[model samples]
Target: MSCLVSSTCSLVPFDSSLNRPSRSSKLGSSISWQSSFPRLSIEIGPVISSPIVKKESFVQAAWTRRSRGEAAKRPNKKSWKQRTDMYMRPFLLNVFFSRKFIHAKVMHRPTSKVISVATTNARDIRTNIPSLVDDEACRLIGKLIAERSKEADVYAVSYEPRKGERIEGKLGIVIDTIKEHGIIFVP
Candidate 1:
């Protein structure tokens, strides 16, 4: 019989045969307690040690098998939002000190352009307003917009030029507007 003290400690009935000193007649005091009782010296053989297997009670094993069977019966993939919410909702709630929620809005203008807005707060407006017409700013803003779109599902709509309209000129104007007002309407 054995009594487990904790996960790392256990007490087992000392085996008399193994505990018997090889040379009992030798009365040398140099030998330590380990040498006196060799059976008490644990010989952990090459065995795979797993916490699940170590502490698994009968009830736990039964419940685990039942859960596994139920999971096998219905296997489904989770959406990006659902997965994100499941992992990050608690963290976001703790950070924001409120319940977390996501709202998405897809707006279609009279022109062919389409604008999308997504945020937890309705008042938060993120416009892809270009800070500068320079190549560096354009690249940085492009990357930022792409990242924001993926995170919040907000797509910035760009206008399609008509026949004979200078695309570069319109782009310059848009950049100027963004630099001045920090936002510009699609089309």
Candidate 2:
């Protein structure tokens, strides 16, 4: 309950008179020892002890530091997801729209395997589709990918668009087409 309000404590300096020389001098030194150090009159009592916190082991210190750090910076999506089952993210539906073509991939997240893929540049799609990067092409690619996803035994999937990507235009059409084909999107 106390702050740092302590008194200064200094030990008495050594004196030659306190040393034992001869047997007769030793006897005289004990009687004169009382007067030898005048500064020894300073009152001595139990110290209040250190006001510092108790010591912590290395692991305890690390845990304390980690807890403080966690409060300062919250867990990001990746760290938050790690707390759940690793296999909880079964499949991921990622669509990439390039200048020349549109590519859709369904990946098995746990095993890092590609389950199904559909692209506008494929032989079947390229020959049938007039424009590879148009809304109709995106829809066809989405439907193809959905059918392929069903063949892979994945009924539901998750998708995260690129950073700062707005869900509209051709991109929106593709997503809608996939959902229209009965491939559920796990948000």
Candidate 3:
């Protein structure tokens, strides 16, 4: 099966010296001449161009310029830690990972009191996990935090991951282990 489509296009001639639309002197119409370009005809699958054109408005141009100027004057945004501290929560869990160590802390957010801690630096964690920096070590830390938080009767926590780091790799392993051990993360 086949289909055919054809479209007519109008072209406005430009006066060389003036550089604007030149009226038709011969036909006495808006179109100055029959454009040498052929009418667009297409078959089946090819794309076709449209005749409608867009013109820029003075109001739109002015509005864009004003918006750009305002954007340039906007102040810097506050850090995530600053924002979280301002809007205090009931409980929060902060996990920090360094090159050779991983640390996890559960806190009473409103009063900023440290409730529980799990770190590779701790003797217990060091004894259980051979390495302090790997994913397995992070999972062990998560399990330790889960156990301590349960004893403290803290069930849920707002997980505060390190700034500029995604919740993947070692961080992901820690979070999964915590959930597996019956602790819920509050995003």
Candidate 4:
């Protein structure tokens, strides 16, 4: 018994510019452009490519591009320290104790009473007194000192003026004794 299966096959030519290699059949016949191209002989397998294109993914790509463009347009910002130092470098010389006194003098308050000086770990209100001093006062003092002399560095020590009050008489006696020791008050 003999069996013959007749089938109609369509052949498509592969473009060489697309880098597709040509194949030949076993029998040397007229080189048909259809047969010259290799068959993609994929086995019965799962469909890998999805027919539906994702529209949301395109939106994400567009957003990414927009953000990149916006970033390129904006100037870089200075860090906190950089900005602060830019404004502070000039006045840094006047931040000393003697300078502070001179600044007080220029402000017509040379004998500015040491209004409850204190030290604290907190950046603001470094005085011993718990009464909250505002930022304006601190800034004003700093500005005054900066405007005056740039000598004598002032550091805050934990000054317990209230405790010192208990020994005010003793302190006065000490001052008197020092004065007698030729401590001339050159005012």
- lDDT, candidate 4, equals 0.32
- TM for candidate 4 is 0.14
Report how far off residue 109 is in candidate 4 (Å): 30
The residue ranges of model 2 lying beyond 4 angstroms of the native Cα positions read 1-65, 69-78, 82-86
The true-versus-predicted C-alpha distance at residue 115 of model 1, in Å, is 5.7
With a 3 Å backbone cut-off (N, CA, C), the pairs that clash in candidate 3 are: none
Highest-lDDT candidate: 2
**Residue range 1-187, candidate 4, lDDT tens digits:** 1112223111223435543433335535665544433343122224444333333324434432335566677647554676764333322111122312212221112333232222222355335424323333333443333322223233221112343354233233332332343323221
What is the RMSD of candidate 1? 19.3
Prediction 3 TM-score vs. true = 0.52
User: What TM-score does structure 1 among the candidates reach?
Assistant: 0.20
Residue range 78-118, candidate 3, lDDT tens digits: 54677776355578878888988899898896678898999
Q: Give the per-residue lDDT digits (tens) of candidate 2, residues 31-148.
A: 5544432332232345455433222212233432346467668655345466553367678888888999999899988888998999998998799878999988988988988999
lDDT, candidate 2, residue 139? 87
The local lDDT score (0 to 100) that residue 67 gets in candidate 3 is: 55
Question: Per-residue lDDT for 125 in model 2?
Answer: 79
Quote the positional error of residue 24 for candidate 2 in Å: 56
Give the Å shift of residue 88 in candidate 2: 2.7
Which order, best to worst by TM-score?
2, 3, 1, 4
Q: Count the backbone clashes (under 3 Å) in each candidate.
A: 0, 0, 0, 4
